[model samples]
Target chain A: MQRIRLLKDRIARKLMLSLTIFSGLIVFIMAFGLYQRSRPILAIKPLNELLFSTSWQPSSGKFGFFPFIMGTLWVTGVAIFIAVPLCLFTTIYLSEYSGARLCKWTNPLIDLLAGIPSVVYGMCGVLVIVPLIKDHIAPFFGTFSSGYSVLAGGVILAVMIFPIIIHVSSEVFRSVPAELREASLALGATKWQTVKHVVIRKAMPGVIAAIVLGLSRAFGETMAVLMVAGNVAKVPSSVLDPAYPLPALIANNYGEMLSVPLYDSALLLASLVLLMVVLSFNIISRIILIRVERNIR
Target chain B: MDRRYAEEKIFRSLTFASTVVIFLTLAFILATVIAKGISYMNLAMITQTPKGGYYLGKEGGVLNAILGSLYLAGGATFLAILVSLPVVLYINIYSKKESKIAAFTRFSFDVLWGVPSIVYGAFGFTIMLFFGLRTSLLGGIITVSLLILPIMSRAIDEVVRMVPTELLDASYALGATKLETALKIVTRQALPGIMTAVLVAFGRGIGDAASVIFTAGFTDSIPYSLFRPAATLPLAIFFQLGTPLPEVQGRAYASALILTSIILIISVVSRALTGRFTRHVVK
Candidate 1:
């Protein structure tokens, strides 16, 4: 008791401690609720069946998760594919060639684009982007009559995530201590050579991290993807196919499911996937942060 | 020299051309939305709930939707602050040795921030259905709170750690009570920073469509009961756009513009608040 008094007050510490537990109680409770719901409700009997089964029929009490999971991965994967390369090239060009005056105007425009709400993107897609794709790009595929294809959704998601990847990678590139650029330039290297050889390599990990973060955001994105992706719960053969990702399925189905166990389980199962992805994203970004900070003088 | 200049000219043009293509599309989108939506931004729109087939010309205004946005976002933001601020306070004050549980709490918070809003919506809807509050404002509020809790707590946690240890020691040496010290001294200093988190949470709450999708399903009429389904601007847009009707379609664009403008306003305010607070804190 004397030692406690000699130290700072421990009694008050106990109250704050309770506060900490209460804050985390919901995440704990929700996670527990999800696990409890996972077994019987989802009918996820064998790991292979859960992973491989194609049909997801709630009417017949057959709940196979393969298609929806594949859809999410495919859409997000396509988004990343379209986004990462363009943003990388854009970042490199901006870092190496663009003037400060131009960058001053350019960078914040991207931020504004980034912060524009997702629903607006969905609306724009609904009105403008979808039609443009339908009229122009989807004809290239020549398979779909109307263009609510995975390709169109991925294209929009790519545009949506572009700012994130560009912003993060450009920040990383800008941090590479201009001395490196100057040194490469001094060695008679062209500006393009200096950037490609020096800046891109140095910032690669951060760029990867940024792309992964963008991937995570795209994976969990609901409103924009839901509005545009032509929510047919099927597997996509190409980027030009219509589909439903896991988030869309949950949003579309939760209302009409008359207390069905499969309904609850499918939603929970989707959430578990979302949870794994977002956690992986944070950890990857943190690793990049660790490495970036470690390398800094 | 002439060849190099020509090459550089081509590179610069390409760079400018690509940048313009991307940003010009964005500008065109914003301009169209604003120009189309501004006509509907009447006082009635700010205050009243219209019945079926609401038109700016006919049904008076979007008063109910605006107010519902405020009510839902305001309640959710308040609830999140209530849970988050105290937890961050505990994290700030707990002596390193005594705070293993606090450490664990923070570990979960990191995970929570990344969880998709739809998942929260799903989890929340599950519970609300169990409790007989399906598709209600209460459900919406709880879901948004859960969504923002981790984000605000993390922001608040970082801000609290900036309060100097010297201040803490001095307050303790003077025999100020722990509550007094944390509340009066540390929190007062951290107020601007904490307010940034609150503002951020509010902006996030307003912007979210995902968290409230299942929890706050759309209704044509304004909800008189917390348990009744309510329409927000985002949900309204989703419904209007999703419908097969053309009239509902035009309204979706106008409504989407309205919804997006609200989120933009919120984002600008939060960013400005954080900037102002950062300046204040640095002083």
Candidate 2:
């Protein structure tokens, strides 16, 4: 019986170790699989023409990714531009100004925001933000829009990512040692000065990591952006103009992808682009986060 | 001196305003979903599947989607736990704390956790094509399990890592093997956290639509087999809203309300169960 127990223990350890190894290799497998699926498009169209040309007539075998890529950049850029300051301000207040009771009360709310489905956000955008923008904001700016524009997508996405940015940067701010704050106060620095100079400075790298994580999330958000961005298939000249992002392209055109020659491969290539960009951003943020954790230790 | 004080006041108010703005955004989303959803919600919407011409504004329910979401998320969560528990256990129990392989494994999970659901959907489609498998419930479960495994494992690993080394040493001195100690002591100590992680992953899997859109082809009827197409709530909302009819769009809001209510219930249940399970934990 003892020998049997020993054998069981050995078997369990080996099983778990192999599982761990498999988990580590799964990321690479996903990337390679996506690449293989996208190989047909790469074979037919040169990389530069596929990436740089603006025409997207799939029925005629013309698949240019430039407009979609531009749409992604514009929307993500606008989202980050709007979200960063709001997230920074929220993080500073929650970490430094709020009482523990207040912070405790807020934590669940942030998690709730994070847990809400993307489709619901999209619905809310359709009901509220879209009409507001089309009726009020665009008119105020002396522009015409259908309310389904890059600005609308960016606004909704900015809100969606607020929880991610706040949750992370607030944790980063919390880990800034209390002694550092106290020491700054003892030297006659104001609370604001201490926050501006000491706490923010100390948490800078982690804050960047948090923002990068949010950026990656915004880059690949499909449902919410797809709902409000109008899926226009054109590069927007302004925020009010309708634009179709890469993820939106994949989601919108995927149903009939098999009917058109090379269409499926093109959509698969879009996902590959999304995967590569998101994975790279994740890696960058992970490196910064690991370094920050090491320093905290 | 006056200028410094003025600057402090300005910055403080700005930060306070921003914090309020975020809270207000959450309130706005909740209120909008509830208000719009309530007007269209009905008993039949939860009890029966879509009838013919349902998309054309006929009467029917999202029972097909409701049941499908439950089964897909449930199966995915179970599969994820089966895989995640072992991977985390290996790192925390079978390997050294600072082992290079363990660190690398954690890093890979973190990266995988950030991969987009849409990409997962596409990759799942790729795998399906290779196996000559059409879109079905099994594809959704496999894809969603892959999507949530990193989330579940990382969460459980964090909790298990907090189990004291002294507890393990005591078990070892009592002639308990590492396997026995892990199953009996460490798992018990981390039960509450593990439960929370499981629920969190389940909520994510259920709420996710992009990863399942192609993998789980929508059906008006409930899924009865793993190989059959399954409809999910998020996709139901998406398709319903895509219609031109106001009534159909109203149903979309109703479905959103249902999804939101489910997540709220999950959050509450996770907290309640955590309290109940913590009775046996040492700390």
Candidate 3:
């Protein structure tokens, strides 16, 4: 019986080890596949021109991705600007001020928001936000408006990433040692003062991580932005002007690849760009989180 | 002292206002979807498939998309669990905490988790072309499984990490093997979390449109084979909402309502189940 048990244990151990390796292999395969498909475009298009030029006429074979790149950066920058302050404030209230009853109800509601489908956000943007921008905000500013523009995409993205930023930042705030809060209060600090000075200072790394994660989400987001961002492949002059983001470019044009000479490769290159940007953001945030965890220990 | 006091008051009020904004945003999204969706929702819409000119605003229902979403997400979640469980177990049981391989694996998962669904669709599209495979249910399942693998694995990994090391030590002291301890003790302790992870992945997979739009190649009829293209709820909404007709746009909202309710149900059920298991957990 002892020998039989030992054999069983050995077999189980080996099986699990192999499975772990297999998971790593899947990541490798995906990266390899993306690289292989993107190679054709990379070989033909000079890297500098592709990264810097705004012209993207695929039909005539001009595959400059500069405009889409700028579009993505602008939309994501706007989203982060809108999301971070609100998320930080909400996290402060939830972690430092709210009672247990309020936390219970609001916590689950936030999770539900996080679980909401992106396409639904797109639908809402189409029916509500786009019109609101076109009919009210644009005319109020005395600007010509299409409603489907960079600002619309940014607004929808801001809503989508609110839950993520709030969740992460709140967790960071909650992890600050209770003793720190009490000591600050004993030193005659108000609740808001303690949170601002002691709690926020300690949680800064984690909060940065949260913001990075939210930025990563905004950068890679597709459907909602695609539906609302007007998909004009040009460098926009204003927030009200239409723009085409990188992921939107790939999604919108991937289907018609055969009609253009290098369309498939161009789209694949866009995917590779998205994958690299998102991966770098995630890696940076993970490093920050690891440092935070080490400091806590 | 007076300036400090004023600053505190202003900051506190600002945070309170932000919290209210968050609540209002949630209320607005729910109200818009529900109000617009309810008028077009009916029994026929839920029970029948598209007939003729469904996209042209004629007639039919969304049963095909509903059923297709179920099949695609269900299969993908099942596949993800199969791949995630053993890897999670390996991390907690078979590997040491500071092992380079373990650390690297976790980092890779974190990166994968951040990868967007559209990129996954592009990746899947490339692989399908390489394999000479067309868009079908199988393609969607494979793509979505990749999309959710990191999510499910990371959730399970966190839960398994929380399993007190003392329990593992005790099991070993009793002469139980690592396999036995992991399979019996750790799994039971982490069961609720694993279930929650699966449900979350399911919700994400079902609601995603960009990932499956090209890979699944939307169909009006419910797919009967793995090789056949499948319709999904998000795709259904996308197609319907793209129409120039008003009634079809209403149908799009109705589809969103159904998708939202399915996700809501999964969230509630997972929370209830997790609560039940919390009582048995050892801190």
Candidate 4:
């Protein structure tokens, strides 16, 4: 019986090992396949030109990534700018001010938004925002500038990233151990003060991670931007000016291309750029999260 | 004493205002979309096609587009589970304990999740082109599976992490071995979480407009097979708006709302599931 049990254990161990390797290999294969596909433009010299150069004309065979990169950055920055303050304060209200019933309602309400289709967001942008801009705002700005502009895209994206930021920030605030809050109050700090000094301070890293996650999401978002953004493939002079994002560019143009290696390469290059922007944000958040984890530990 | 009393009033009001802003922002968007979509919709307008250029008048029953969207998204999401479950179980529960090899393997998925969906679409596109599956349902399924994998994997990972370590120890103590324990005990306990993950993944894939556009192409026809191109709701909305016909434009809004409501419902249900699972696990 003992011998049979030992044999069974060894077989299970071997099977588990094989399964793990197989699963992990699929992830590796998928990632490497992407890397291989992008290698042509992702190579040093061409990528440098794409990144630093300021020109973009596909017909002219000139593709400078600066405009798209800047567009993505500005839009992402705007989204973060709009989302963070709103999320932080809302987290405060929910964690500190709200009754249990309100807390229950708000938490699920926020998470519900996280699941909304990006296409719906686009619909709102089109039916609501476009008219609001075209009929109301664009008149003040100029006639040539249509409703489709960075302001429309960035603002719409702000609404899109709002739920994610709120949900994550709320979760962090909720996790800040009730004992800590009680300790601060016992020390004579008031409700708002305790939240500001003790609760927010302790949860700052996690809050920052949430914001960064929201920013990365804004940067890499493809579909909503595709529809809302005017797809001019240029850097915007202002939020009211039109621009293109890397994800939008990739999604819009990649399918239409014939087997031109350079076109395919450019699309891959676009992916890598979007990947790097998102990865850097992720890496930054991961570092903060790691530090936060260590501090909590 | 006067200063302290005044400060209290101001601070309380500030928090109150902030709460209102968050609450209103969400409420405004939801109410506005529902209002706009419903206003544009009428039965005949839905059942008929457009006359003027796109965006001019609402027209046509989005019957074909709606059906196509459901079929493709549903099929792709189903196929994703077929491949991802075993993969997730292997990575999460079946990995060797305390092994450096296991850590490296885990890192691979971390990197995979970080890769953009467009990269997956492009890679899938490359393969599809090679196989002559351009603009077909098969291509859409592969692209969507890749897109959903990271999210599905992450959700499954969360569930695996939630499975109490003590349960595993107990299972092993019963002489069930690692595989049997994971299959019977850990996964069983984590079923709700796993299901929620799959539901969310399905919603995400179904809601995706960009990934399926190239892979599935825009087809009003419901696909008879994997070889046929199928237009999901998001793609249909995109194509309809792109057209010059007024009726097609109206069809876009109706389709958009349908897709949005379906995804919203799925998300709400999954959110409830996750909340319940967490509460149960905590207890």
Candidate 5:
């Protein structure tokens, strides 16, 4: 009986180990599959041309992803610019100045914002932000904007990513040693000075991780951006100009790829690019977060 | 002295303003969705599937989507839990605290968690092609299970890691096997956390749209089998919002409201249940 029980234990341990390894294997398989499917496109089109060409007419065999890449960068850049200050300030307030009552209310509210689906954000953008931009912000700039521009995508993304930045940064700030704040204050520094000079500086690495995570989310965001980012396949001349980002390109065209030869491969290539970019960002942020935790010890 | 005080006042006000803005944004989103959706929300919307000409701005409800979302997310979350429990157990119970295999697996899960849902969709599409499988509920569930496996496992791992080492030591000292201690002691201690992880994964899987768009081709009727195509609330909202007709667009808002409510309920219920479970926890 004792020997039988020992054998059962060994089998269970091995089974669990294999299951854990299987989880990692799935990611490898995904990357391999994407690479295999995209090889045909990679063979026909030089890497530089496929990545740098401005024209994207798939029917004409012109599959430059440059415009979509630029669109993604511009939109994500704008979102980061808009979201960072707001998130930073909110985190500071919550961590340094807010009373327990306020923190109690705001934390759940932020979680609620995080839980809301991206599709709902897209719907809200379509109904509210899009028209608000078209009628107000666009007209002020003297540009004939349809509201479905890069700016609209950025604005919605900013909202979508705000919770992540705030949640992570607040945790970072909260972890700063109380002694650091007291020491700053003991040196005749004001509360704001303590937060700005000591707490924020100590929390910088975690804050950067938060921002990187937010940026990754913005770059890969699909349904919300697709709804607002007027899907024209051109590099936008300005924020008000319509543009197509890579995820939108894949989602919009993947279903109909059979009509045009090599289109499927091109779309697969786009997915590969997105996967690589997102995976790198995730790794960089994870390294930073790990360092932050190590330093806390 | 006055100069320093004035600077502090200005900066404090700015932070306060930003905090208020975050709250206001949340309020505005909820208000808009509720105002637009309340009119069209009815029992029929939750009870009946889409009828003929439904996409054409005609009659019928989003019952198919409601049921399909529940089915797909429920199925995926169940599979994820089955896979995740063993992985978490292996990491915390079988391996050393800083084992390389455990560290590498955790890192891979972090990367997988960050990969966008659309990439998963594309990857699922590729797998389907390789196997000559068409879009179906089964494909969606499998792909979604992959998407949430990392999330669920990571959450459970964190909780399991927090279990007091003394407790495990005691179990081992009593001549219990590693598997028995893991199953009997650690799991009971981490039950609440495990429940929360499952709910979070369920919420994520149900709300996700990009991951399912290709693998779970849309339908207007309830999918009777895993092999059949299924409609989901997120996709329902997406398709409805794409229509040029005003009524169909209204349906989009209604669908969004339903999805939002379900997520909100899940988060709240999980929080409450987690709190209750904490009371019974060893820690």
Candidate 6:
């Protein structure tokens, strides 16, 4: 009986360890799958040509990814610019100034914001942000936008990432020891100065990691960005210009256009690009976060 | 001193104002969805599927999507738990505390957790093409399971890691096998956390639209089998809002409301149940 029980335990351990190994392998498998699907287009066109070409005429078998790549960059860039400052301010306030009661209310509210579906954000963007941009902001800049500009997408994405950036940044801020803040104050630094010269300096790496994670989230955001970003296949010259992001390109054209030869490959290549970029950003951010945690300890 | 105090006040207000802006934004989104959603909501909206000329202001409902989202998220969460529990249990219970494999597994999950749902959709679409599978509920479930597996594992792993080494040693002192200790003691110790993780993953799976858009292949009717195309709430809203008709657009708000309500309920219930289950937890 003892031997049988021991044998059973060994078998169970082997089974579980194998399952764990298999789970880790899945990320590589997904990357491989995307790459394999994208192989045809890679074979047909040089990678540089495929990535940098301006034209996106898929009908004649010309599939240039430059416009979509730029579109993703522009929208994500604008989102980072808007979100980072606001999030930093909010995090500073929450961690340094706010009372525990305020945080008690604010944290759950932030979680709720994060939990709101991206589709709802898209719908809200259509109703509110798009019209605000089309009628107000664009005209203020002396330009006419149909409300579906890269600016609109950026605004919506910025809002979608607000919860993420704020949540991560608040945790980062909290990790700065109380002793450090007290020490700064003992040296006669004002509250703002303490935050600026002490807490912010200590938490800079963590803040950057938070922002990078937010960047990855913004880059891979599909439905909300797709709904607002005017799916024009051009490199946007300004925030007000309509642009088609890579995820939008894939989401918009994938299932419906299998008949278009090389179209599937083109879209799959877009997916591969998204996968690589987002994964790298995530890995970088994770490394930074690990380092920050080690330093905090 | 005067200059320093003035600068501090200005910066303080700026931060406070930004914080207020976030709160106002949250309030605005909630109010808009609720007000617009309530205006169009009726019993039929949740009881019947779309009918002929539905996008043209004709009578119909999003019952198909409501049910389909439930089925798809439900199945995916189940599969994710099945896979996640084993992987996490193996890491926490079966492996050395500082094992490289355990560390690597956790790292991979972190990366996977960050992967976008659209990539998953595209990857799922590619896999379907290879297997000659059309968009179906099965595909959606599989893809969503992949998307949520990491989320479930990481959440569960955090809690399981907190299970004290002393407890495991005690179990082993009683001659309990590793498998028995894992399944009986560590799992029980982490039950409340596990409950929250499952609900969180389910809420995520249900609200996600991008991963399912290509794999599920929306239909007007409720899906009857795994092989059949299924309508989901987010896609239902997407399609309805795409139409030019005002009535259809109104219905889309109604659908969004339903989706939001389901997620809200899941969160609330998770919190409540976690509290209740803590009675059984060791700590």
Largest lDDT belongs to which candidate?
2
- Which candidate has the highest TM-score of all? 2
lDDT of 5 by residue, B23-60 (tens): 99999999999999998788878888888898887788
Q: TM-score of predicted model 4?
A: 0.87
Candidate topping DockQ: 2
Clashing pairs in 6: none
Each prediction's whole-model lDDT (CA): 0.74, 0.93, 0.90, 0.72, 0.91, 0.91
Residues A82-120 of candidate 4 have per-residue lDDT tens digits of 777767877788878787789878776776676677777
Q: Give one digit per residue, the lDDT tens place, for model 2 in A1-297.
A: 888878889999999999999999998888899899889999989989999999999999999999999999999999999999999999999889878888989999999999999999998999998999999999999989999999999999999899999998998998889999999999988889999999999999999999999999999999999999989888899999998999988988768999999999999999998999999999999999899888988
Query: Where is model 5 chain B poorest over a 10-residue stretch in terms of lDDT?
Result: B274-283
Q: Of models 4 and 6, which has the larger DockQ? A: 6
Candidate 6 has an interface RMSD (Å) of 1.1
Backbone clashes in model 3: 0
lDDT of model 1, residue A210: 84
- The residue pairs found clashing in candidate 1 are A151-A239, B45-B62, B47-B63, B48-B63, B48-B64
Error of 6 at A4 (Å): 3.7
Q: How well is candidate 6 docked (DockQ)?
A: 0.81
Q: In candidate 3, what are the lDDT values of residues A116-214, reduced to their tens digit? A: 999999999998989998999999999978899999999999999999999888888877899999999999998888998999999999999999999
- Using Cα atoms, each model's DockQ against the true complex is 0.43, 0.87, 0.74, 0.43, 0.80, 0.81
Model 6 per-residue lDDT at B279: 65
lDDT order of candidates, top first: 2, 6, 5, 3, 1, 4
- Candidate 5 lDDT over A41-101, as tens digits, reads 9998898999999988888999999999999998898899999999999898888888878
> Which of the CAPRI classes, incorrect, acceptable, medium or high, describes model 1?
acceptable
For all candidates, the clash counts are 5, 0, 0, 7, 0, 0
